[model samples]
Target: MTKGERAGADVAERAATGRAARDRLPIDGHGVFRPPADRADPVQIVFDQEADRLPDLLALRHRRMRASPLAFYRGAAAVMAADLAGQPDSGLRTQLCGDAHLFNFGLFASPERRLVFDLNDFDETCPGPFEWDLKRLLASVALAGRANGFGRRVRAGILSGAAQRYRTAMIRFAGEGELDVWYARADVDDLVTRLAKSRRRRVTRVGDKARARTTLQAYRKLTTVIDGRRRIVADPPLVVPVADLLPTVDRIALEDRIRTMLTGYRSTLAEDRRHLFDAFRFVDMARKVVGVGSVGTRCWIILLTARDDTDPLLLQVKEAGVSVLAGPDPVPDPDGEGHRVVAGQRLMQATGDIFLGWQRVPQLDGRTRDFYVRQLRDWKGSVAIDELTPRGLRTYAELCAWTLARAHARAGDRIAIAGYLGRRGRFDTALTEFAESYADQSERDHAAFRAATKS
Candidate 1:
């Protein structure tokens, strides 16, 4: 067996035996499974250590060998896995949103044009400890609260509310019927109404109106046709034009590969989408820049035109490689990274895009990289977390909790988790304490990140 495979086997064995390879596992107040506190300040560590190391991190993710198929969870996964190795866990594993920060939660346009909230980023997603996700979520809440100018007391309360909601929702979910839990979703209109009832009326009004306008604007900009070309125009730091980022030779090669990739990607979809792709031809393609953490990664957008002049479809092909959290065992498949992304998305989301699929493309360096394809700018948008008031933050946290429980229910035994939590709210208190402590760590981490970037 290869070294990676042997390592995977070892990890599997260790996990089976309830023993992680790393020492100094963290135990919670109840002496249950928890992450080691020594490395508990992930936000601080990331901020301090990686602020100026974005290029290195990006390079690390792109190091997969040609034709070698390994899941690429990226640098975030490696950090999380090592942190998990040091923590005591409940042995409850699911496809975790490895980087469940506040910004990662967002608004998206569903097929019906109705707004919905869900976990929007999956770069670090993988099968892992449930608490790891909770940690990330809680830390993000604190970090975002700080960023929004909330005082320590208010931030603490927000963190408490978020944890309380998560615990309460999980218990309720455990008692719910599977179908009921499956269908439970928070609509954007309902969320806005709920926020209006809270103390932060001014913030709620502004945020709701802003989100509505932003969503409409995003749809119009993304759907606009230019001479039969459906493409998103780059607006500098926020949106880099694909044409500016690629060399002429690479751009040409990408256009050719996109045509080939679309054909293969469409085959993985349903008959209707396959027929849809078959009816369209590629017109323009470019490397589109996006997201804070994902800024430097290889993400491309392809514009296609239907036989009819007015018909258009935009597709994004994001590069996928071995996950940084490969543990001990590694698998081989040219599209393994893309497959990992596809699998993780299915496991975590209640619903997923119809065009989701994996492909392998030979790079200019004669190496092959795996990538997952999805529609670009199909009513995609996010909330401005920095604008939320304390009360609004609380409401948002509850929504996040409700969504998280629903996601976890789909992949694992909700009953057992709910039972472990019970109706006493002990887990709520415990998590609140954890969040406060972790938030303190995150601030330190953020400062470290700032320092790293400055230096």
Candidate 2:
């Protein structure tokens, strides 16, 4: 057969695979959300994750999670993973963001210095049924809309519309050339141009804030000159220097161990990136409390400087644990969980951090842990979900959905998945129903969690 004929045959085979998936699980089957009779206690599950996290920061994590149902949902990816596991999937596999909440989508600088919108978190990312991500995203949309006081009808429209965007975007990708699909991205400037005048002002302000969040900005905000030496400012429970975290006798030893870990992490990067990393010398390190979900996890911000204190590079060393979506029997990963996060992030994002790397380190607590390292901040900013109007929220959710579809298309079988969704609103309707029901479940779980920790 000719090369053109072979390509045609491949497309047909993938389309057949997608259509056959419908037989295993019909489109409407997605609407159902019957909790298992022996479902795990969601509150207990949230506490269970605290076992490996920093004990000193557990209280702060609890406080953050207890803020609202939406906040609780953000930190309760494990709770939702259990529920998603109880359902039958469409068997369409993709590198899932696992925690694809609405807030996870944001503006960040691309390698070429242009701002782009895409999924930014991948702590729980792993390969799984594609709808698992869709479900996670849709539920967040419902929760966010409800939190913003949008009525049921408005929330429903947003949910369905978001799902519809994912479905239609996948269909379009299915017909595009491989290169076109792979190179597709959501440019923030283009997005602003597409919005109405009133909305443009809001989004442009967000874009400008993100642009100002460069490493230099972080340097000024997070550091101070103390006795002719630049040091990370201590903010107690939120940000504490390593020296404050340990006794003077142990500080030097801990610094030595961290330097060794950095060397190991550097080996994981490409030779060119390693050369770029070599220019910076370690200056100071600190433990920082970050995000609603990642609060208790071990997170360290390492300060590296080259060409004096003015040129500073901050790297975040965040713990990477077993993905909540990992199956009963996960494949052995020699490079460990940290590698899992870096691999998934590279696959899903159009532009990744130049310093992205991973390492396994033996901790002072007498346990070995995996950690992924990356630039602490690079023009990263998320729109205030609470500030968005109902229409704005809907638009943002749909943009997230489209961005997700592009990510999935780059990592999964776009043709097959599109074939499964077909050309209708059935999948969208079902997804909206499931999202509302799951949001209700999350609220109940949040109440239980609040009651358990009310003391």
Show where candidate 1 strays beyond 4 Å: 1-27, 30-81, 190-249, 307-309, 324-335, 364-366
lDDT of 2: 0.91
| Per-residue lDDT of 277 in model 2 | 92
User: What does candidate 2 score on TM?
Assistant: 0.97
How would you encode candidate 2's per-residue C-alpha lDDT over 343-406 as one tens digit per residue?
9999999787888999998865678889999999999999899988889998999999999999
Q: How many clashing pairs in candidate 1? A: 17
Off by over 4 Å in 2: 1-9
| Angstrom error at residue 418, model 2 | 0.2
| Cα-based TM-score, every candidate | 0.76, 0.97
For candidate 1, give the lDDT of residue 203: 36
